[model samples]
Target: MEKLKVDGVSVSFGDNEVLRDVSLTLMPGELVSILGVSGVGKTTLFNVISGLIRPSAGRVLLDGQDVTGSPGRISYMLQKDMLLPYRTIEDNCALPLLIRGESKRTAREAVREKLPEFGLQGVGRKWPAQLSGGMRQRAALLRTYLFSKDVALLDEPFSALDTLTKSSMHRWYLDIMDKIKLSTLFITHDMDEAILLSDRICLLTGRPGTISREIVITEPRPRDGDFALTEEFLEYKRLVKEELGA
Candidate 1:
């Protein structure tokens, strides 16, 4: 069954419409990417999905139950890692569980047990400022996962990293997702990043942003090093380019 579904959603600020008939679905354990130009309400769509903004129309459903405008139902990581410098990595990652009212010790213990699984072993007691950008991102992702193991919404979480770091993060994220099986829906403007990480890409275009196409990346997952250099990658880019141009 589809884990999360956005059904014909629309959003507007006063008379200016920001989204129109936007809709998509994330199946269990699937990683989906939403691609669009800046200021096309890509973030707005996320706000709606995360229940920070109510859609002007349409329903947000999780596992077939309508959950529109309800916060805390799914995890969300903004563009920045947003880690707290003063807090220990373990403390930072435990914020979600803490918010759910878990005792501090229990939260830390839960975070500690998953640290290695998240490629974050031995860093729990360290400050966020002491970690590298990639490490911080992993910590942020761990925090996000703590919110809801079933689903997450990531907004350009790797965009700020150096090329090598971002590439490394992608590989690490894929491996971790394989083990955790979290359903992810992320927004990114980078074509290569989208193609490299997503099972399917939703192209959002138009003055009032809407899905222009749903392009499946059929090359398969845990993609190899050469996958990016392959004709298949170029083909996906070409298709996205054409759809954006149309």
Candidate 2:
């Protein structure tokens, strides 16, 4: 069964029509990328999916049930890690469980048990400011996972890190996703990042953004680090560029 579905969604803010008939689906354990240039309604689409913004038209469904305009149904992470500097890493990650009615101690314990799985072991008691950029992202992702293990809406979550850190986080994220099998839909402007991390890429284009193309990456998951340097990867990139030019 499809894990999540965006069915013919459209959004408009007064005179500005930001999106039109945008639709996509995520299967279990699938990583899908929304690829578009800036101001192309990528974030707006995510907002609709995350139920923060009810689409002017269309339905958002999770596991076949309509869940449009309902917040807290899917986990969402923005470009920044958004970890609290004052809170301990453990507490930061435990926020989700706590919000859902778990006691503080239980939340901390649960977060600790899952820390090593996320490449975070001994940093639970440390401040967010004390960790490197990559580690902070790990913490943020852990928090996101704790919030909702079913699906995640990531908006350029790794875009803020330096090149090396971003690359490292990419590998880690793929490995973690392999273990957890969380259905993921993310937005990114970086072509390379989209190709490197996605199972399929949805091209959002037009004055009022719509899914102009859906390019499947058949190369397989946990793709080789050097895959980006290959002809097949270049072909996919070329196709994306061609579609964008249309």
Candidate 3:
């Protein structure tokens, strides 16, 4: 596992700045969430970290090596699953391996063995349209894991799922994350989701968004379904709301 650091980063498009002096560290095996309202540059910050957009200043470091402006160093999953409609689920999940020059036979074999763990056993032959929203996300996440085992950048991955489906996904994700040893830095507007899933929550605020505060969740992982109803959870939510000026 590798540590990801966004050090003193800033981004600007012409005279309009999107982010400024943003710095955060994603420790190995840690799940960190960046929370803010729309248009606050959460996604912009992610792009900087993922090296899709080079920050105007500062640097992105992975395991102590500078990787700013470089793509493919870390796995990135957006809001949509982005699975090709014509491809079978297995083919979609095996894309990372294929891109790395793995033979078709080898990639397929690897996906088959790993499918059950992501709760998509025997569905590899099906198309993306055949799966439910939650199932598609599981496949997407598994694909992300295959790309880079060390770290993943998720952008509201479960936002589209219904309440029940999202709840189920939350539990399943936490369980598999431990087994897979994948650290994550995800962006979410949902305070509840942030509190439930994050080891620490970075509250991005102000125009030209910055890390205004980082709220840590002290409760242990694998929290029960009722954890959200607890006072501690509510308190965390309150803190975030206050920070975001909600």
Clashes of each: 0, 0, 0
* CA shift of 225, model 1, Å: 2.4
- Scored by CA lDDT, what does every candidate get? 0.92, 0.91, 0.92
- How do the predictions measure up, each by TM-score? 0.98, 0.98, 0.98
Task: Please state every model's RMSD to the true fold in angstroms.
Answer: 1.1, 1.0, 1.1
Q: How would you encode candidate 1's per-residue C-alpha lDDT over 92-155 as one tens digit per residue? A: 9999999999999999999999999988999999999999999999999999999888898999
Per-residue lDDT of 77-130 in model 2, one digit per residue for the tens? Answer: 988889988899999999999989999999999999999999888999999989
What is the C-alpha lDDT profile of model 3 across 1-246, one tens digit per residue? 349998999999999999999999999889999999999999899888888999999999999899999987877887799999999999999999999999999999989999999999889999999999999999999899888887989999999899999999988888888888888998999999999999999999999899999999999987767899999999999899999999
Clashing pairs in 2: none
Greater lDDT among 2 and 3 belongs to 3
